[model samples]
Target: MTLEGKHALVTGGGTGIGLAIARDLAAKGAQVTITGRRQEVLDTVAAESAGLFGLAMDVRDEADVIDKVAAAVAERGPVQVCIANAGIAEGRAVHKMDLAFWRNMMATNLDGAFLTIRESLKSMRETDWGRVIAVASVAGLRGLPGAACYTASKHGMVGLIRALSEDYLGRPITFNALCPAYVDTEIVDRNTASISQRAGVSADEAREIMVSANRHRRLIRPEEVAAAAAWLVSPGSESVNGQAIEIAGGMM
Candidate 1:
């Protein structure tokens, strides 16, 4: 069915895959609320799209998530779709990794998803239909050689989604995670620079290193991930709960 008049909330929607998903949902006739830490970026993007609104909220803060999500529900009606997409991607060798680095990774990638999902569920439970899509990573399915912390965080996110799906097995709501590999987003740009400096390789070489991670030898597009998300929240997806759909070009 179309998303006409439904309310969809996407975290980290200022840019990247989250923004792409927000745009797609809005185009499908959903009233979308996109959240990020930057009001300006969120506002600018929302301003350009009809039926898309912006809010500034950090998922890492439980109180903030609770309040902001409540406010969104109060204004937009019950949230029929919730996407937890805010995350940080950084790699560090086990030996050189500090406790601060590990904690930060877990807080943003795992804890943030948890808080966002938990808060959203309150409103979702009051409704008859709902969808929760967590933006996980392919690293969760296996491992990334130097990204132990990030991999663990993503694994946690996938686990959380899977468990939630089971918890609501007989309900009208569904919980699923999208695992994508090396998408061509701003995160990749930042990762390219980080990899170049860490590996002492040229920028182009570092970029290729990531592209090679995907079996297709290319960067996956943000729209591809957005499309998967759109389908998950659309009609004919009622039985697709708890699955982590991999967009990794056969990397699975």
Candidate 2:
């Protein structure tokens, strides 16, 4: 499906799944704005594409999110396609998790998605069409050991999107979430190291543990998730609102 002239915004678009989505959208003729906390990373990604615009903004900060989105709207027009993909994934047992760890996960995963969607909606509501997609985790749909805070944050994100989809039932805009398991990203690499250190196992063993987490017994590539995001923005997905499209190798 062609996205000609559509203005799309992706949070944490400097790398991983978000960057893959930005590239796919740009390839489909959309004017894409990629936001991240690091200017260097944004610059690197922007240099790779013609229509991809990069803006340095921290999604966890309300003021930063609002200001950057406003700037993007001013320059590229209203964000008709919004992707809230900024988040942190950390696993700590419930009893061992302190307030700081819990709050950090909530702030980045849940609150960040909320603020990004809210700010983009201001400009989106003025338009005739729009789409809001949140990048949640499989943990959102089920209990994940040693990830109580992270799982709760993702669950909250899906809940928020489902509610908003219902609130705008008849509107042209759609709200949905993409839940993927064991994605092949930097987060997975970090988690592997963490698990190896915690369990006193080889890094390869830790990685295998994550791969086994998926029902298909493999790690998902970032492009796979991007494809799902692209399909959600296509015309055929109009009737697919309020859904969490799980890309966990049939784990859902």
Candidate 1 per-residue lDDT over residues 50-149, each given as its tens digit: 8899999988888899999999999999888999999999999999999999998998999999998888888889989999999999988888889999
lDDT value for model 2? 0.93
Supply every candidate's count of residue pairs whose N, Cα or C atoms clash at under 3 angstroms: 0, 0
74-186, model 2: which lDDT tens digit per residue?
99999999999998887888888889988889999999999999999999999999999999989888888988899899999999999999999999999999999999999
Candidate 2, residue 230: lDDT:
91
> What TM-score does each of the candidates earn?
0.98, 0.98
Q: Give the Å error, residue 184, model 1.
A: 0.3
Q: Score each candidate by Cα lDDT.
A: 0.93, 0.93
Instruction: For candidate 2, give the lDDT of residue 203.
Output: 99
- How many backbone clashes are present in model 1? 0
Task: Flag regions of model 2 displaced more than 4 Å.
Answer: none
